[model samples]
Target chain A: MALKLYYDLMSQPSRSLYILLKYANCNFESKLLALRKGEHFGEEFTAINRLQKVPVIDHNGFVLTESVAIIKYLSRENLIPDSIYPKASKQAARVEEFLEWHHAGLRLHCAMFFRVKFLIPSIVGQPEEPKNIDGYLRRMEAALKEFDTKWLGRGNNFITGNTVTVADLFAACEVEQPKMAGYNPCEKFENINVWLKKVRDHFNPYYDEAHEVLNKIGKNKFKMASKV
Target chain B: MALKLYYDLMSQPSRSLYILLKYANCNFESKLLALRKGEHFGEEFTAINRLQKVPVIDHNGFVLTESVAIIKYLSRENLIPDSIYPKASKQAARVEEFLEWHHAGLRLHCAMFFRVKFLIPSIVGQPEEPKNIDGYLRRMEAALKEFDTKWLGRGNNFITGNTVTVADLFAACEVEQPKMAGYNPCEKFENINVWLKKVRDHFNPYYDEAHEVLNKIGKNKFKMASKV
Candidate 1:
């Protein structure tokens, strides 16, 4: 049986996982889950992942959730090269550092911004609160600053170092999320701006394919202004 | 040169790393930072980690932050044994899942509860907002319920399975943080109650030593209603 991947491209983590699996050319069956329709809440999907979150994988009856974990698992399974996560302890540690920092830092702020600015208004039919959005925006910018100055560091091509790792993929999905909501990430942070373009080139077709939904939304609603 | 760890025991992540290092019996020097005194903001500490967070490790001048990352790094460096993290790919992925889910789930809520219920009132000389605390309490309860039902499972001795992993260590620090503020974790969730005791027993002297400051706080001010 092939590995089963449950995902939704609209989700940042899912996009990262999808891009990783596709980029690695792993033999996995894709399971599309639409968040707007509450498809994940259905009993069938919930049974696979009680948390009902996307980017879950089931390989030979062994199930796993959490994008970072899934990606790491794939790497360990030899589905992808160790360079993506690094087998060298210190280099691996650097990637892990970026990932852990990402959850509380960038991921949190970007999700908050997306929920308040885009999801609630467009999906939930709720009025977008400018005050709430503004607070999230400020926090998001602060997180970006940290990403640019601290994590990316001075003269580093990628977050951990010269090579593009899973950290870059996870970051690209999250930092790019706010762009769909009319927030320009690159305009505010030069380093992330440059780094993102490099990551884009590295991931190539998989990145573009995984981000199809987001790109469509960007072209239609956001005027594709986020492409910078 | 021995690894130098910068930590404040009162902080959850710091406590996790501190407990891990001590439990592993790794050769390391402790650099304690008093978070309550704003010492982390000082130029000296900020130079090591610009984010100014505790639970940072400098291994022969290779500085690393984020407790999960540090723990993973230590595991990779063979400073700790693989049983704590598991060298097997699938088992390791399960541990990683718990850690990643942990940051967004329990850690976020418990930290929020601790901040609103205890930190702001004690450190900032601000009044505790019952409404805010109540909101956090509800969310914390939901997170605990999910953790107990989903992660702990029906008859698993540990989170992933029979063996105790680093996930248990990180969880012990975060989940116990609220106890000092008078929140009873065991009273609310039966599974968590059982699991926590097992984790506490696993760490023993190190757990007690690392949590001494919090224990003192619970003893003096909070009245310690959280003992299961």
Candidate 2:
């Protein structure tokens, strides 16, 4: 049996995982879990994940979830670069560091964008809170500034001083969400735009397939976030 | 030069890294990045970690930050067993699953507990929004229920299935925070209570000796949280 990747394109992490798997050329059965349709919350999915979420990877009988860990696990298998997690223990520590901060910073901003523009409007039936959205956008720009000034550290393919690691997967997928949700990521942070382009082309031809489906959301104010 | 840990006891992740390092008997220099004093935001500290946060590790010239990444990086050095991260991709994925969910669930509770009960009261001189606290607590408790029911599987001594993984370290530290901020963890969860005990015996002793200056709060409520 091939490795099975359970995910939904709607989820940022799941999309990251899907891209990684696709980029690595890992042959696996793709399980589409649309949480909007309540597939992830179903009993069968619950039995497998218990968390009732997507971006789950099951190898035969063994099951695993969490995109970061899964990405590292896959990377170790020569799917991506072996250096994705860092070569030295201390370097690996930096990778871990970015991973830790990424959640609260990049992850939060991207999620907030989707929540404001997409989730609230489409699912929750709530109008966007401009104040909240503005707050999140400001934070997103700040993160990109910090990313440009600090983690960019002279620019690598990923956030932690170059080389495509889980960081890129995270940064790309997350930053893309705002676009899907109708926000301009490229215009807001030009540095992030460069980073995104590098990431988009780093794997080259690799992410084209994923980006095709991902780019369906119209480019409007959303393109203003990152200055490409 | 021994490994150097730049930390602030007040930060949950820094404390977790400290405890994990101490428990492993890893020889390291301890440096305080005083957040209260605004020391972490300095140019000097920023060079150490661009994120300007604690829970950072420095081995010689190499630097790394983020508590979970730091702990896993240290634990991987063979202080703990391989069973922690698990060599299997699927098992490793499970660790990521918990860690990712941890950011939203456990970390949120811990952050809210600190922000509302302590930081707000201590710094801004205002009580936190009660509704905010209650909402997070209720959500956290519900998450705990789901974790206990399905995630724990058939084990003891850790947050995940059987052995202590990065999950436990991330969780135990976060769980302890609510107690320090005046939330009782032992309100009803039996498994969480039992598990907290193991962490206390395992990690508390280390913090006792190494973190001598800090008037660490919440041991009593740790007992409360572990009421089972």
Candidate 3:
């Protein structure tokens, strides 16, 4: 089976899928897109994906977009373990619930905070105003609180239950995003910190490898902010 | 098999599932919540769903949230048809792709437009500022343009393909939402109007039934605006 993945590590969902594929021991062609350089919008990539989003897959000739959809497709083909995405109705629903909620919940607030605090400022070559930064921070914190109380407070080893699933990976990536903006989620949400560590420990080198670019950028951002 | 669905017709996903259940001929006890009356926030409903969102399900003792997850669970149990949510990998991926994208793309923009232009104003007892309304409209229109070009323009009679799947149901509900704010999508986007008509015709009676409340509110809002 000829499979090709187009992704950017800087993107959270992209990283989540990257780690998932690695964990599954699936070998496929990696067609990385440099999102910061606007490569996703070019004619070639746009032809591959009309949506022009990263974390898309081309299996043989069939192309699929959306990370969650791609992951489910892969699971259906038996390319990924059932443990990562269960086949049982109830167990699978638990994971699916988190995946669906993640879009508008953790993902939205975390992405918004990162954009307003780090991405926009870097692109425009200026710091964001305190009020705008605070607004996004508040939203991010509220989502984090929900994640802590509702998700982790379930007293499971992961988001859905004792076993780690894609839900945990997806949530961890989103929580890690605002680190580039000098906001550490672990500092505020204790349960999230513990759960994140467990997910990272399970994924190991793959998790760290997928986040290399983000971690470097985050460290640099912190150093620069400290100097200012 | 004791099954119950907690939903509000005013909620898009709730209506989507409601129609899906009816379309599948599944017998489910309806537990409707009046969102306008803040019924979802009551202690009784809160115990059923910690998220306090509609479109939740209880099967025996198992409780599930999120419409997409609930639909998938139902499909897994053979409670729904293969035509509605294809089990074949490639075909199912097509439906999953639309479902995944719907959350952040069409749903977000359309809901934002409705909230800003109608819901908030109704609750606050005043009209929204023109600037705020314009901002959300632009975002919603951009999302609609993408939907028209990328989704409906794929040369298929429906969002995924010729068959009217749950994807069409979810998309149609979101597209219908802005009508409450006096935004008729059919007027601006010809393709959406045609595709929407097809979905409505395919699932009529049930479609019309699920949308009764929204349609009434939409007409009343239009009448109120006309008087102004």
RMSD of each: 2.9, 4.4, 1.1
Q: What would the per-residue lDDT of candidate 3 be over residues A1-228, giving only the tens digit for each residue?
A: 588889999899999988998999998899999998999999999999989999899988999999999998999989889988898878999999999999998999999999999898989999889986888888889999999999898878899889999999999999999998899899999999899899999998899999998899889978988999
lDDT, candidate 1, A1-228, per-residue tens: 569888888999999988888888787888888888999999999999989998899998999999888877887788877878787888888888889889988999988887788888897677577776788889888888988888775777988779999999999999888867877688878888899999999999999888787877765655534353
lDDT of 3 by residue, B1-228 (tens): 588999988889998998988988999998989999999899999998999998899988899999988888988889889988898999999999999998999999999999999899999999989987888999999999999999998898999888999899999999999998888898999899999999999888899999887888889988988999
Q: What does the interface RMSD come to for each candidate?
A: 0.9, 2.3, 0.6
Weakest 10 consecutive residues, lDDT, candidate 2 chain B?
Answer: B207-216
lDDT tens digits, residue span B142-189, model 1: 888888898886699888898999999888788888877778688888
Question: Candidate 1: DockQ?
Answer: 0.84
Chain B TM-scores across candidates: 0.94, 0.80, 0.97
> Which candidate number maximizes TM-score?
3
Error of 1 at A194 (Å): 1.6
Candidate 1: global Cα-lDDT? 0.86
Tell me, by lDDT, which candidate is best: 3
* Stretches > 4 Å off in candidate 3: none
* Full-model lDDT, candidate 3: 0.91
Count of clashes, each model? 0, 20, 0
Candidate 2 lDDT over B157-203, as tens digits, reads: 57666677767766766666665665656567777778767766666
TM-score of each: 0.94, 0.86, 0.98
| Chain A vs native chain A, TM-score per candidate | 0.94, 0.84, 0.97
Two-chain DockQ for each candidate model: 0.84, 0.57, 0.92
Candidate 2 structure, TM-score to reference:
0.86
